[model samples]
Target: MSAELPQPSTTSLADRVKNILIQPKDEWGRIDAEPATVAGIYKSYVVPLAAIGPVAGLIGMTVFGVRVFGLSYRPSFGATLSTAVAGYIAALIGVYVLAMILNALAPNFGGQKSEVQAMKVAAYSCTASWVAGIFQLIPALAWLAILGLYSLYLLWLGAPRLMRVPQDKAATYTIVTIVAAIVLFFLVGLVASSVTSMFMPRMPLPGGTLSVG
Candidate 1:
């Protein structure tokens, strides 16, 4: 068996986030060298970033309020809190699901299969999107969350080093993984929305209290 990739003695979270955005090539090299476990990766990276969107959304929607399709709206505090917690948990699970899908699909895409490596790629490549999620703080700027598109580039660069995909197969691998992730997320969101709706209190609408979004 090969030697383990050494974990850095002091990898600052802020520095890692900055490096991944500003210096991804070098950053991915560093990430590819670091040893990690599924749980460790969640504690170190996924858990924190996953909260960015929901936390920001909670504050923005509840405290500051925002226009929904040009109509002023604010989710009740209870609704916001429940939604935030549910979304945060969903985000964490989404990463793990994506990692599993990536690992399972690797061999079919001319990539060496390794679940640990796939998890790392799934966790780190998502940094851009999680960071972009902060735009949730300002609903108007939420469209800028499209910046997560940058992750596609990050994944393309990291695939060969992290997932061991051949250069020619990297694009195919990335595209496949991304598509799978989108579908998985959509399903997760649908389920979460359904569940949230079932328990969430209805708010007064133009005419009466109706539980609708």
Candidate 2:
């Protein structure tokens, strides 16, 4: 709640991380003061990792010894831990982008400032990414299951937040924001995946043409 920069709970690093990584939608203040902008709400959602990412990665690596040598809990069948991590990262980026879109478009549903509130929504989303990534180092279909659950849970949580619009337009905003955000996310994901697919390497055909077609 520091005015300098809207911060998550300052109790401790772990607690702050929890706020950023899980409970990201709420803010101590309804509006930001210093920036004299409405976007603080959205950007606050982005700021948590301003400190957590590097520090947490360092601590995690140090404590875990930079390798999962004996992680009995991790799945060990198909893809290596690295690939699972890669997939998780991909999903994270997709979700973050979706959150941004929601922040921008959903606010219309609520009549709130999209620019600032995006930060909170984005933070709230990391919860699913981390929860799935918990054992993502393992390679199985489990990641898919977790991802599905994460998507559902976000919508469930977000629906309420989206509805709390000013001027008493709560119900309309809730349905519009929640539904629009989800639709836009999938649309964005398809566009993104297609673009990435274009850059993917393709094997040569029997006649030696490299066409993905």
Candidate 3:
């Protein structure tokens, strides 16, 4: 009898998924649209950062007051857990929405345009932020650096994929983006803090009163 014919081996679906997860970008199809992409990133960053900083600061201050001042607790365990979960969901949605809107806006300019793929990239980066937030208790300094690096990595990965500018343009845009974002945030923080404080109406009881907030 002739030797049995060899059977074709097939990769299972799980194996396919694993391969996809671990797959690297195709070097041959690489894009160099950094300028437009980086500009897109900055556009997304500026608005959301402007919006969220105050909310974050308020949350931080509220948590600290609760712990340090030992304010009377009204919320039940269920309520607290629900609020935390809700907050996480809200943040994720907010991040995604911010990316989508700005990406839609990126293509209007001559120097910059949006790549649809960037939406996925931005989502992934924000997802990383969500995951890393779980480790916020990690030694404060180290955690800060880790969060920052993760953010930049996501931005780099997601932004350029959707941008279609030349290498020099991309690099320049990226640099300007970082620098301008830092400066912009400083100004926003200064302005937001001042404006919010002045207009937000301070609660009178400096020492102790019912804030419920």
Over 21-125, each residue of candidate 1 has an lDDT whose tens digit, in order, gives: 899999988887777777788888889988998898888766556454444555567767877888888888888988898889888878888877888888888
Best by TM-score: 1
TM-score of 2: 0.46
Using TM-score, rank the candidates from best to worst. 1, 2, 3
lDDT of each: 0.79, 0.42, 0.39
List candidate 1 segments past 4 Å from native: 1-9, 192-213
Query: Which residue pairs show backbone clashes in model 3?
Result: 33-165, 34-170, 35-170
RMSD of 1: 4.0
What C-alpha RMSD separates each model from the true structure? 4.0, 10.0, 12.2
For each candidate, give its TM-score against the true structure: 0.84, 0.46, 0.42
Across 1-213, the per-residue lDDT of candidate 2 in tens digits comes to: 755854443344355445433554442132222232334422443334332322333233323322223332211212123332343344546545655655666567554555444544444444444444344222332234256346445544553454245645555655565566567557744764454333332322132122111
What lDDT is reached at residue 180 by model 2? 62
Model 2: CA > 4 A from native: 1-13, 16-96, 155-168, 187-213
lDDT accuracy of residue 4 in candidate 1: 73
